[model samples]
Target: MARLPVNHPARPIYRVLSGLVGLYILVFGVWGTVLTWGEPPFARDGAWALGLRANLAFALVSVIFGIVLIVGASRRGNLGHYMNLTAGVVFLVTSILMMSVLQTSANFLNFSMSTVIVSMLFGLILIGTGAYDKVGPEEHAEEARKHRFHPVAEVHRRR
Candidate 1:
């Protein structure tokens, strides 16, 4: 049985959008991993308590989410969508919480910018991808794969 109907309209858009989000996850994973070990920004900050808390919180969240997406994508192939959806929700919730915290802080805009950018961008991308996925057809995905120079599936010839 096909996973999606043949006439679905969102297949191509979903594939591309999700692919972009997957790329972003991979890139951010690498960036966060590198930052975790190197000379981190919080290291120089005199406010050790809040700085350490924020740094640890950010690192932990990134590591957890990154691992989820990477493992899901590599192992399950299509699970990246669910992983990204969850990640987007997490970003939105975290952004809201951080924004509330910033409301009473001195560096309100500066600190909030990172969370706002990350939340908004990821939310938009994931929602777009999800919307496309809702209309995507499995048959079209297969056809698109056939036309590609680098097909995703292993081609099996005559036995």
Candidate 2:
């Protein structure tokens, strides 16, 4: 099995980056909600928030997602790792799905091309953050580092 680095030296930086992303999303959602208030849930007219087209429904979902990401980024354990991973995948998948229906009535979120691009970007960032945020004791970290540098030897030792 592939092993992620534990107690990575850059974990703090990644966490802070993830938190910044969450903050952006949170602010975007709140701003979108305010700008799109009293509009139809999926109105595709001409409502833009933070450079992305949004509707009431999309803004509401963004609020929830933003909050989840913020909470996850604040956690100091594997919870953040797992949450980031999950959120990354969700963002990627949602972006693709929304992109496919960009010009169709089925685009309930009223997503624009810019939104898709931003979502994909955020997804990649979150995944990268998650990949390096795993925490472990020094022994495990040392073992993981060894395995990373000497895969064959580590594999043989495991067996």
Candidate 3:
């Protein structure tokens, strides 16, 4: 396996991840609001998410966010990382709050143990991925790998 640069980040990968998550939410939103004609964006249809019921409103908001994330991530700028960080943090918070803040019986949304874990995991990933942007793009993983064990061929001494 090749080694990654100490600071180089896989920004494109992170961008795609955010976009994919958004796509998933978009699908869920459409599925949830099939016939209600937007009556409930956050409705709890008693559907299970990670073994817990999720709110319809969450789905609606998720779809909108999904579009935002996808667009942001696709761009080659700091905005992509910003969106990833934002979404990631929100998911992380929501997951933790669902499992801890809300009552266990309140399965109105999948704030269950499963969602808590999954959301937290994804949230952290997004956060980590976004961080690369602030560090500034360095060298590619392969390029760094090539130089991993190599040392400077020559050293110049200034008098």
What's the C-alpha lDDT at position 8 in model 3?
48
Backbone clash pairs for candidate 2 read none
Residue range 97-129, candidate 1, lDDT tens digits: 666665454432234445556666766766555
RMSD of each: 11.6, 3.6, 7.4
- lDDT for position 68 in model 1: 60
In model 3, residue pairs whose N, Cα or C atoms come closer than 3 Å (at least 3 residues apart or on different chains), thus clashing, are 41-56, 41-57, 42-56, 42-57, 43-56, 43-57, 53-109, 53-110, 54-109
Highest lDDT among the candidates is held by which one?
2
Instruction: Give the alpha-carbon lDDT of every model.
Output: 0.49, 0.90, 0.61
lDDT of 1 at 41: 39
lDDT of 3: 0.61
After the best TM-score superposition of candidate 3, give how far the Cα of residue 22 lies from its true spot, in angstroms. 1.7
Worst 10 residues of 3 by lDDT: 150-159
Error of 2 at 48 (Å): 0.7
Candidate 1 wrongly placed segments (more than 4 Å): 1-7, 38-57, 70-84, 103-111, 135-159
Candidate 2: residue 68 lDDT (0-100): 90
